[model samples]
Target: MATEGIEAVFIETHNWGKSVKFFQGLGYQLEFETDHNSGQLRNGDGPTLFIAEVPADRETPLQLVLKVADADAFEPGDGVEVVTPFEDTHFGTRLATVRDPDGRLWNLQAPAEDRS
Candidate 1:
């Protein structure tokens, strides 16, 4: 896999405003937010951070998302477990999830190709 680097870190927060404020206090400027209580932020040239409100019944884990050249072509090495298969996301990207040896979840994303 031709991995680029960390793309974004996803954080699930119970209080969206508080979380946004906390990151803002740390110098991350809000780039954009969606109606569903999710936003992307960045501090300088650092990796982007994505914060979203967790649903009542779902527990969202802190996922480290890595940028890859092609999500469909990524294969986990030995001892790495595939949690979710790569699929096209509604947000215009391909995403897959994997579990590390320590049980941490990692998200892999590939930007959508231009159909035009």
Candidate 2:
């Protein structure tokens, strides 16, 4: 399937407040936030940046998220491993995660169908 472009960059942070402040210092405007210790920010027309707090035991990595026409239809090239199967998210998006040969995570996302 064709890619729409980058949807967002996902960052796992142990210190959510500090990370959000750091981005805000860079002029990123807060888009929205959830009580689950996560939020979305944007700088002008650029791709959105998503920050979420992760467990201290978990490794925090920057995730590059690609926007596709359909997340369920994504087919990874050779050497790419599926990390998370495509699923509908609570944020009204369908998404999946894959790891490249270098172990960098890539998230694929598509707008979920409106249930309302």
lDDT of 1 by residue, 1-116 (tens): 75688988999988789999999999999999999999999999878999999876888678778998876677667787889888889988988888888888788899876679
- RMSD list, candidates in order: 2.2, 2.5
Name the 10 consecutive residues with the lowest summed lDDT in model 1.
69-78
Clashing pairs in 2: none
**Candidate 1: pairs in clash:** none
TM-score against native, each model: 0.82, 0.79
How much is 45 displaced in model 1, in angstroms? 1.7
| Candidate 1 to truth, TM | 0.82
Which regions of candidate 1 fall more than 4 Å away from where they truly are? 55-60, 72-75
Error of 2 at 43 (Å): 0.7
Scored by CA lDDT, what does every candidate get? 0.86, 0.87
Give candidate 1's root-mean-square deviation (CA, Å).
2.2
